[model samples]
Target: MKKEILGGLRFFLLMTVLCGGVYTLAVTGVAQLVFPHQANGSLMKEDSKVIGSSLIGQNFTDESYFHGRPSEVSQLSPYASEYKEMITERTQAIQEENGSTSAVPADLVMGSASGIDPHISVAGANYQAKRIADSRNVEIQRINDIIEANKEKDLLTGNEYINVLVVNAALNRLE
Candidate 1:
């Protein structure tokens, strides 16, 4: 019985070292070697200063900048009254901000699945173009062009998305 107990102890130690230490190191090393940019949090930089990560959303309430989707750290249930009320409020706010009577895009009113998604649907970006243009005192065409340039297509769905941070950065660069 003592010998059996010793054997089990050895097995446990071996697995703890192999799985906890060695496996973790191997995966991290592979990630660093193969995808260094992503492994490093996909940070965006400006003038050698870290601005933000491309993988995370930022809250921009300034009228001069385009806004991202509503961020909810914990998503409310779709059937909940709070969720319905929040959606209604967001839709009204977007309409008022953009001076649009058109229906607001779903992305504008809904929180993203991750709640930290940096990208918004292309339509969502365009919906705010007028406000951004007015605030920046630039032509609407310029804002649209910037949106066009930064738009990315999803691999599976082929739907276009624009990173709000990138678009806002481009807006800042406008002379």
Candidate 2:
């Protein structure tokens, strides 16, 4: 019985080292080697200064900048009156801001679950492109070009999105 107990202890230690230490090191090394930028948080830098991460969203209320989804969306129950009211208000505000009499994109009114989703749908970006162009005093085509340049497409889902930070960063570079 004592020998059997010793064997079990050895096995446990071996597995712990292999799984916890060795396996972790291997995976981390591969990540660092192959995806260095992403492994390091996918941060965006400007003049050697860290501006933001490509993987996370930042709020931009300036009309000169393209906006992301409404970050202040309530997390209340969907059936709650407050949630409905908030959505209505956001939709109206988006319409007013974008001068669009048509339907607004759902993402513009709804908050992402993480509240840090960097990517907004192409439609959402397009909705605010006019406002951004007018505010920045740039041509609408220039804004469209920037949107196209920063657009990302998911291969599996075939969905297109644009990182707001990236777009805003590019906008900042405009003369």
Most lDDT-accurate candidate:
1
Error of 1 at 15 (Å): 1.5
lDDT of 1 at 147: 95
Q: Which stretches of candidate 2 lie over 4 Å from their true place?
A: 1-14, 72-77, 99-101
TM-score of each: 0.88, 0.82
Residue 65 error, candidate 1, Å: 1.3
| Candidate lDDT (C-alpha), each | 0.91, 0.90
Where model 1 places Cα greater than 4 Å from the true spot, the runs are: 73-82
Tally clashes: model 2. Answer: 0
Q: Cα RMSD to native, each candidate?
A: 2.0, 2.6
Question: How big is the RMSD of model 1?
Answer: 2.0
In model 2, what lDDT does residue 136 have? 81
The CA lDDT at 171 in model 1 is: 84
